[model samples]
Target: MGGNGKFHKWKIFYRPSPSKSDETHRREPPPKEFICPICECLMFDPVVVSSGETFDRLCVRVCRDLNFTPSLSDGSIPDFSTVIPNLAFKSTIVNWCSKSSAAPPQPPDYSSVERIVRGLMSRQGGAEEGKSRIRCTEMELIDAVAEMPDVNLSHAVTELAHRVNHFYSSSSEESVVMTTNPPTPLPLATRPACLSLSSASTSDEILNPNPNSEDEEFVAKFNSHDVYEQEQGVVALRKITRSDEHCRISLCTPRLLSALKPLLISRYVAVQANAVAVLVNLSLEKTNKIKIVRSGIVPPLIDVLKGGFSESQEHAAGALFSLSLEDDNKTVIGVLGALPPLLHSLRSESERTRQDSALALYHLSHILTNRLKLVKLGAIPTLLVMLQSGDLAGRVLLVLWNLANCAEGRSAMLDQNAVEVLVGMLRRNEFDSESIRENCVAALYALGHGSLRFKGLAKEAGAIEVLKEVEKGGSERAREKARRILLMLRGREDGEEGDRDGILELGGLSRTRHRVGGGVGKNATIANSTEF
Candidate 1:
């Protein structure tokens, strides 16, 4: 009975064998959506373009760099103007890879993709040349005419002139017979000949003349495979856009921006530096600011800030500062992680980079979200260090004033012992510009208003003595803020509610809230008063 039970268990656990066809069959390839339209490789970083087509980010960048547009299977051209990440498609590709037990796709090397694009461009060029060869050919049909004897040509010309005169005379007589010979005008026959010649000249000009030929040539050089040519292209663009406002507006097209995008992060120092400098020029026009940001150029600018050549980093910081002047770009710049690098750049050995980075931070920190981000990134400590070192003191103070407007910033400032730094600067009269002194006082005022801890920190730093001096000798704006800060600090000392009530009832620092140098409110004092 035991043997029979064991046999029964074996029979119950038995399974069917696999067929030969099943073993021989292979896994299917990944779906087409996984492939980049430009590189024809499995996409790792898929981004959707304006035309609603998905492509690898690197692939799109290469296309923009080369100024090459590939035709899709449906014969549509993908718009390379703007691109945003396609997170849903990327997640799908990952899932598909996992289920198939296949290695996930990785971004193809940029050079390899570039080579592929160049090849496609070459092939397309050859085909287009073949189709337009006859039309574009410069054959000299006049040579045959020139070869004829002079006598025969003269005779032919005379014969044609005789027939034209006869036709004109006949028409003129008819006109004379019909009307009372109204002042004899140029013959109708001559009119056709003249009109034909004028139309021919106009058509020739329209077909052959190009006013922007120089700019177009420069733009074409950027698409060259040679790095030197690319460098020359960027240098020429920089020069043209620097002084010519018209060129700045005209060259700020989507196509040119697309071509200039990749070179902004070029590995070559000259190329990257000049490319970013050109971007700075392009961004000088107010209209180009938002367009440049929309072209997805900010990320490369940020990358330049983080790791580019020193010269390129300076231009990158300047470019960011230029872009930040536009209110629409402030949130975008901060959101794309520019705050930390800009903060980090404050300590750079290059003075221009430090100043530009500081100014950029000042403008960007005006946004509430950006102020919070700066605080979270520990900017207060760095700014305090730079402030005490007297590197870009006025600009650094402006950034601190903006930070003082936010609650998180105020807390961060208190935590970083900012009160002592400002008080010490005031007591020592370290600033050269009265505006900087005023900014210092305004920042302290903001800190006092936002956080109660400011009272304790200021008292420890002997802020009362510094405020008295500022009240006595500083500008009217500085004196007012100084008195208000003194009242807040003095209120803390007297332990009297009326002291607090008087501080508030003194119009709640009404003079500080008045517009200073066209400033709208208390917060605008630093932004408007200091000209970084």
Candidate 2:
């Protein structure tokens, strides 16, 4: 990224050997060190690497280029060790010793397969040797393993896919482990960690060990069966970087994301939010989102949003909002305990953050889905306080508009005097006259559709007077809208009486309110109903 990302003709390099006939063909100086020969940089401590061929980052271009190769003639094994040599170490040392640097050899265009393979085989870590070096993050290591000879990167990735409950299983593991790559050999304590790979199934002794009450002879036999893994010196929770972009990793072998979880549960706000955002990015897939929501992470996630700084809060809020959109995650936050943090974000200093929070709350309150949750979580009052801020008015209205999409939302809107506040706004033209007014009216219409309560409140609050005046000389759209509202009101001014006896019902209501929905129907006794 630092050097010019320009492409050069393929100056293919051939290994020079003494046996070649010089008369028939002269050997060149290793093709003029094609493709930079080597980046004069430090190797990852105890490790050295080089790309036998060069390919651009994006995998699409390689296919078009005839030079790129996706598979070997056999496609049976990887040819990295054969086709590509780790020659960068020697070349880099040579370049550094003699400062007379020449332009790196330009290589031929990469073929499609080459591009894809190169992309799949991304090279990381050409670090300076002196300074503290970083450990490859779980992803970096995974990418390395994926690119290795004979191993199918895609297949390796799929081995831990969500289909086999891998997502849930992984989430349930140590968070620290989840955060990094895999288990690394830490300094072996007196009672060091013994590792084993239970890729498919485990032995009887490991899967279900006998209780202490079991016969000692039987238990002793099982104890001898414990598997010990290859132990090598490894840094857990080490920084993962390519000398420029850096990430952190916990271990090297078994699983990432699950490894650094312990560190993530730090008391520091930045630490918590950082951990959550990293996980959030990694959990971009649907299964990941679903698994996290179900894993008991909502509380910690909420805490980060509620207690962290503006940026951290924003990150947490964004993560929760993302989870709110997924079908599997929609109800999980509320059920799993993410409500409070979401409400907290509404009052945040950042506008984008507040908007996202409001949007999440809006979705949560869709009809009867999480409307009760909204009320129970005390979202209404927070939503109201937010409306007081000029910056929040637009988003507040947007949320209201979407919430109105559901039947229970409409009912709650009318029951909570949501009608009263909205009517007051319309009566005095409190919001912006164009788009704001349109959105407000739209919200009112949705609420009124479920029950005549909204219509009655609007009339009594003198909203009708304002609507009538606006309709008198207003645009055709405004006039048509007011006329319809009037119809819904059925000329009633008091909510005690309605034109029709339609019941817009939800399960959770006050004991006195009628229960008219399926699922967890409880008391809908929340007097602050409309507020949240």
Candidate 3:
């Protein structure tokens, strides 16, 4: 579905002939050395008749046995005594077979579908399942289904969705509940607030496997095992992801997500994590955000973020971050108490977990209400530590900038000595990107707006010289900001003129755009030089 005409580099097999009119000349077929005269398939156990015609040994033997006189290519009877095995042809067949076997296995075709069906049946009760039990995982089966032709795959998805819908509707609540493990109570601080929230809730034509009977039977068997069902659900989700945008939107139904939520309580960490990962991927499409959030995925996801394994926590944080992009979901996540775990993740050993946590905080802190909660949870000190050493310095700085927007946040930053850290970042040549410097200077400006003590703190941390250099040579946005901070430090405004050594409004400026994360569309304007 995503095909584009950019495959010229992959056109390695053919070079178009310069003579376009050469279509009049037909190309000859390949040499017969690779073909067999009788039984037509690629030569295997080939024998050369006395007439020097090559035929499959089994075909010749069958013909000879079926008739008293088997006519050869020369129309002469061949004596069984004269027919010796064609050693060279046999050797060629052996070599061909060897090479074929050594090559990597191609993607599954019709036969693979048959194998997958057999595996499913064997899981129910089939002899072949034992023989090939180790061959394909549930994930591999889902991948193979997704790789089917577009029409067949879409049909498969639709059929599977219908079956899931049926199972959900027909099965009693008690039955479904019995299939899942009892939910473990989350910690008081991390427990989901939405626990009782009433949330509104592949392939092939013969390469087309039988969807109803096999899928139904397999799902019925899968229902008895929580881990297996979670695996199946995860694979189904992964298959949807491999499809096109339209397909993803179509398959990510509320019923499907509702069916998956119970799997979060499974004893298997892999299952819980995979379910959250699927939700994260599905939530990337903005239209799906409300459906997922309303599906009651938020509570379980927050629970996973709170205490699941590191991988699961990372995905949960990412999901929350993306969901928070929709304005309504920000309060939903924040009220559920997502801040503590997200803050804890900032100190996690896994870099991915740390970054996802920071990103979530970056979004959460954008809310004025959230900033107060975050500062209370000690976000300022944690962010300062991360700003100094974490990989998400730019993100950390942006969050700090957001917090610096209000009086309470400004108080928190002042308490955390944020000015010293931000100034230190400005002073390091290696630490300065346009975003980093701009945020640093703006933050310093915010922190130093009215507090002489902070102004002194910044100067002690080498901010004045950095501001002078920024005013002279940094981006225009940074320069203007530096001009403002310098003016604040010098106790003057744009109209005030000064001597050569004193701060002055620099002119002939190079204009440039500067945007801090999460504050892009809002004012690029800093708070008043007297707000603090």
Candidate 4:
């Protein structure tokens, strides 16, 4: 995804605490005010309430008030309460814990189980375990305590959370710890109620309300008329794109892609084609990059391109284009024969699809320079077919320019006799349309750029004459690309070693070679052309 898919940088950060010497300036200045847990000053900022296990004491207090029991760590509340006083809860709890030295946790039985049992465990074991916890026949004593009057189990639950959160908030200083990953602030109501057993309404939490159900509903109801329309014609080749993203996403069992292979060719073309493009882009995303690429999904994309798709071929072509540039991606695309359909798309009626197709070819042509299987795969014929089409002058020019710009097709250019077709397009009789003139000049430039040897050949083949005509017409892009070709051919006439100086040393020669709308008399005339 990075430029040329070669070199990329990832940023990482390390936070080193300031040393003691610099602590005066860097350390968090001591809390400007007491961040009391009861007051909920800094909202779940550690309160440092008597640390070890104060919740056990609160549980005892509730049990005492309920006149029920602690369902103690080992015994009922009454029995556990007798061992510790209400005032000395902390010391008693610690001493009792120390004396008991809680037994190490028991491990689950891992002796060999039947294959069927293992499968059951894998599938339904979690549900079974939850059932066991809630309805165990052996825990009669535990259930009886749930009936406790003063307990108000909901209040106790809220109180316990409040006390725990309150205790922790008071534990840490009230300084803003500026970090990309500082702990998220607890909800105001939850934080305060969590500390000291308060029941205040949560302003932040209550206001935001249900986030998902409403979002899902809104997303469902949102207008998809636009999505449906967008997926029509050339864009409709991406129908499966809107099918999953905008319209069908609202369906009960919506899918971004399908596993049940489409039944009809039309279905496959509509859904699979867009899916191919979607999968390609998703493969570029940071979140989906690893999963998508590793899943080996590209083979199907390559298949679609290779097999061909008249309705949605561009999607596959574009995807294949991108995949060819990526590491390990070209293997499948190459095998599935990605080049043919992409070439077809360049001659497509839809300009958008053709552009994407051409762009992919250009990208493929510019890579590593050793992937000549693309060039040998009849890329020249397909490129010329698109280039020779009268309707595609602009697009054809771009394709030719890119082809001639790179080293990938240099050898193929000479071997395939591409120069003659390109030179054939460099006609000067009809230079009235800026587009035709520009395309003519571009084709010449592409031919001239192949090599020093080709540059002279291209000039002799009338590339230089077309350049003079286009420049005479004042087409800026044509003039620039054309001027470069003229300078390159002049340098080529001289030996490659002697004076390689080309565009840079054109100051004196420009008066004769570039006279805009007029000829420079005999000075710039070629051998066969009369100096009229």
Best by TM-score: 1
What is the per-residue lDDT of model 3 for residues 61-139, given as tens digits with 9 covering 90 to 100? 5544332223334433332212335655566655664554422222233343344333434454434333221222222
Q: Show the lowest summed lDDT stretch of 10 residues, model 2.
A: 229-238
Per-prediction TM-score: 0.56, 0.42, 0.51, 0.39
The candidate that wins on lDDT is: 1
* Colliding residue pairs in candidate 1: none
Better of 2 and 3 by lDDT: 3
> How much RMSD separates candidate 1 from the native structure?
23.5
lDDT, model 2: 0.41
Clashes of 1: 0
lDDT, candidate 3, equals 0.53
lDDT of every predicted structure (CA atoms): 0.65, 0.41, 0.53, 0.37
Name the better of 1 and 2 by TM-score: 1
- How big is the positional error of residue 396 in model 4, measured in Å on the Cα after superposition? 3.3
Candidate 3 wrong stretches, greater than 4 Å? 1-226, 450-453, 493-532
User: Over 4 Å off in model 2, which ranges?
Assistant: 1-254, 268-270, 283-288, 294-296, 388-391, 401-412, 430-433, 469-480, 490-532
Residue pairs whose backbone atoms clash in candidate 3: 204-207, 204-208, 205-208
lDDT of 4 at 216: 39
Q: Rank the candidates by TM-score, best first.
A: 1, 3, 2, 4
Tens-digit lDDT string for candidate 2 (50-80): 1123222222232223222233232211111
The better-scoring model by lDDT among 1 and 3 is 1
Model 4 lDDT tens row, 1-532: 5788688797889999777567545544323222211121221112111111122333323323433321223321112212122233333433443454422212212232123233433454455434322211112322222211232212111111122222211101121111122122111000111012222222222122122222232222122233222122212222222223222222211122222111111222332343344443333222332233333344344445444344235455544443444434433343334456667666666544565566555545443332366566666776676556654454444445545555656556656667666666666343324544555555455555537668656756676676677567645665765666677777743222211122112111121232223345444321111000
> 208, model 1: CA deviation in Å?
20
Model 2 clashes, total count: 44
